[model samples]
Target: MTVLTIIADIRIKPDEVEPVLASYRNLIPQVLPEPGCLQYDLHQDNEDPAHLLFFENWESRELWLDHMKTDHLAAHQAATDDKIESLTIYEMTKL
Candidate 1:
């Protein structure tokens, strides 16, 4: 099975960057323990502190899909709802 990679671009209200970061930080531990998750890391742009990016690698598309239903993911989304200005997720595979 082919591995899946995802890049998530997240923009938040400038004032809420810290809160959103906390939410993501809490989520990482949960995601890391899940099956098929190879890596899940978060990054912030030096120029734009409110802009966050997630670099993720998974064992398969199916496993990644399963992750979408996880409670931690849902909670993170809910907690950051008001703080989030925009979100874009790109799913990719090595060519």
Candidate 2:
């Protein structure tokens, strides 16, 4: 089975960083227990508090896609709406 790796790079508006972080705090726990979820860790950029990343591992792309459609994920997105400056998601496989 091919493990799927997801790197989500997010830039939050300077003043909205705290709110966005709070949303992630709620989202991560919901994600970790889901089927095929191997890891769903969040990271902050030391130099730039407004920049954040999610380094995730899943059993397969299909499971990850299902995760994307989950209610918790939608709530997070709604909560952070307009607070995100930019977002980038990279889906990959190990060599």
Candidate 3:
């Protein structure tokens, strides 16, 4: 098994930050039940309100890929397409 963490430095338009965050909040319930998904969370930066971060855990890389291909993920991508500034992904394994 593997653990994957995706840190997305999403940049929302000054006025659209709240709505963009709300959209991400609404996706939690929909994304948590995906096969192999163990945990999902969202975080905001204290210094930079426009930056958003995502923490996700999955059983394996393959499972994570599957989750990425789901309709829910597609919607997520569409919603944040141009809104995101940069995204960084890290894959880890238990010692």
Best by lDDT: 2
Residue-by-residue lDDT tens digits, candidate 2, 1-95: 89999999999999999999998998888999999999999999999999999899999999999999999999999989899999999998889
* TM-score quality measure for candidate 3: 0.81
Write one digit per residue (lDDT tens) for candidate 1, span 1-94. 7889999999999999999999988899999989999999999999999999999999998999999999889998889999999999999998
What lDDT, from 0 to 1, does candidate 3 have? Answer: 0.76
Model 3 stretches with alpha carbons more than 4 Å out: none
Which of the two, 1 or 2, has more TM-score? 2
Cα lDDT of all candidates, in order? 0.94, 0.94, 0.76
Candidate 2 Cα misplacement greater than 4 A, ranges: none
- Model 1 residue 27 lDDT? 90
List the candidate 1 regions with Cα displacement exceeding 4 Å: none
- Candidate 2 or 3, higher TM-score? 2
lDDT of 3 by residue, 6-91 (tens): 54546666666777787788889998988888888888889888877777778778888998888877897798667665666656
